[model samples]
Target: MGQPVLLSLLVLLAVAQGVVLAYWAIRDRRFRSAHRAARHLHSADTHAGRLALVGEIAGSIAHEISQPLSAILTNADAAENLLGEPDPPLDEIRRMLADIRRDDLRANDIVRHLHSLLKRRELQTTMLDLNEVAATALSLIQPVARKRLVTVRSCLDPMLPPVRGDAIHLEQVLLNLMMNAMDAMASNTANGAAERILDVTTDRYDKYSAAITVTDTGPGIAAAYRPRIFDSFFSTKQEGMGLGLAIARTIVHAHGGKIWQEGTSAGGAAFKFTIPLQAA
Candidate 1:
């Protein structure tokens, strides 16, 4: 009886081990799939693509690093001048110190965001509100548009369904498109189009997907360039290195979405990207 009981116990142990191994294999497979998608995004195979990505990464590093460093230097200069005063106001110095800290934190955030943006990471999806992401992007762009003397308006559907995507990356994608729209408008200086209106909207594209559109009051992409606008190293702007649209396309594709452009009724450019909505 004792021998029989021991054999049964051993068999049960083997079954448990098989279950554990099977579970890990399934999880690893999923991870590998996601990792492969991430790898394709950053992988530079073609010569032209690599060159464009390198230039983009360099310029982005410079832009991200310089802003906060400039702010820190400006604050330091102000603090130094304040220190030279016979009656140095502690309150003022304290404010400067706080600002320096804030800017330093901002620089750190930029570094982190860029790292996440460029690094190969698995796409972690969650049910995310598209309107909220659009709203946040608009709030951030409003100040930038104001500085450029452009107006940004939004008409987001409050009842829009949630999509499965990484929220941070979605926001980045939205901002990228809006920035392109703004740049398109900025280039309109030659066209004498004074009305620079950037209209952003979100609505249901279909029963299974939702769309976000950014329309700009500027000359739309030429027929020739429209085909290659999202291609690597394709740029309309003189200073553009042409990585933004490529990156945007990759992100949207990875999320099982599609992005495209067209000429809007307002005689300007419009870009619309759609993502699959999560099932109820």
Candidate 2:
């Protein structure tokens, strides 16, 4: 009787071990699959596409960085002149140094933001403030907006909740929407719409989601094209590959959010997207 019971116990242990191994194997496969999909989403093609957008504002970026550099040089020259004086104004020289340092940091930040966008990497999730993300995107695009004479406005909600997602990807989405808005208004500058305005706003869509909207004072989407606006490779621009909206939708959806366009019969286009707030 004892021997029979011991054999049964051995069989039960072996079955439990097999089940555990099977479960881990399936989990590992799922994890690899998800990782591969994410890599594909942020592939070399996506990076190239982003670089193309950067190229559009390359001159503006150069000018933005050059301004700070010019300031630093001017301050340095003034400080040198002060040193040459018999009774140099040490106080003034200190102020000049401070100005130079500030300009240096400004230039560094511009480069850092640009570099972060250009880098190719996997998605990294973190708690983020949508307001800050919008502000950063605006800072990066301000030079371009100024060059094009587009008035940019932002209304960020101070009570906005934190969201869980990749900040870089979210910024990319915001930049894409804002760029598209600017492009939409480009033709309007010559047409009836005299005021070229781009508005970005952040707020809570509901108890669980934070939303952002990018609106433009351009001619709204036609009734015919409204349905397939987010479809891949459906660009209205002659030189556009039509992936911007598609990618934006994908990224937003991946974060458990939704994106949609508001009708603008009066004259203007609004694209809004939401990201779910982090759970308690």
Candidate 3:
């Protein structure tokens, strides 16, 4: 009887050990599968982002090139008319040629900028002036703001120190923030009031970092949605793919910065980010 009892206890112990081992094996497999899936999804998302940026640049180039091309055609026609006459005006022809050269240069610059922005290669980091980048971004989007009746107020601190970052990525970050703010205001304008306003400011918070704030006088984000606002595919806008803020945050983080949103004093949302100041 004693031998039978011992044998039963040993069998029970072996079965328990087998069960534990099986559980661990299953858990390990699950973790590996989850990690692989996450990486695949991230890769797909990155590819999609690059494609979308390409589309945007193509559209902008089409519009930008159209203006200069039209000007070149007009100038060419004017020059031809002058030559068709018995005596062509040499000064007018020279002026027309100068205009054509200027337009060609403008077109070349646009293409170069687009190529730099759309490059899929790694970032080239260097010391960058926040005020200059902010101004350039605002200039690019001012037309959109004006069309939506949004007023932009810039308060850039000239004394701020430069930061180390990729110029193109930094510009994209600022442009995305401004466009998001403009979109938020436009939504409000469509529903009720058209009092749209955006405030973009840059200041040095301390010796260590510089801050950039994009504030909008639109409806503030709900408390429930605030936490997930930076999450991918979690946009509040109808047409938003929910990737802009996510991509912006990633870029800021890559530059050793942090991006976040908070309530503004004027009853709206404020997106603020900070980057470490470069050693002077």
Instruction: Score every model by TM-score.
Output: 0.61, 0.86, 0.73
Better of 2 and 3 by TM-score: 2
Candidate 2: the clashing residue pairs are: none
Model 3, residue pairs in steric clash: none
lDDT tens digits by residue: candidate 2, 1-280 = 6998999999999999999999999999999999898778656546666677688777999999999999999999999999999999999999999999999999999899888888886567899888889999999999999998899999999988899988878888899999999999887654444589999999989988999999998888888888998998998788888988988888788788999999665589999999999863
* TM-score attained by model 3: 0.73
Q: How far is 203's C-alpha from truth in model 2 (Å)?
A: 0.4
Clashes in each model (backbone N, CA, C under 3 Å)? 0, 0, 0
The local distance difference test score of each candidate is 0.78, 0.88, 0.80
Best model per TM-score: 2
Clashes by residue pair, model 1 = none
Q: What's the true lDDT of residue 280 in model 1?
A: 36
Tens digits of per-residue lDDT, candidate 3, 64-101, equal 67888899999999999999999899999999999999
- Indicate whether candidate 1 or candidate 2 has the larger TM-score: 2
Q: Which stretches of candidate 2 lie over 4 Å from their true place?
A: 1-38, 190-193
Query: Candidate 3, overall lDDT?
Result: 0.80
Candidate 1 vs. true structure, TM-score: 0.61
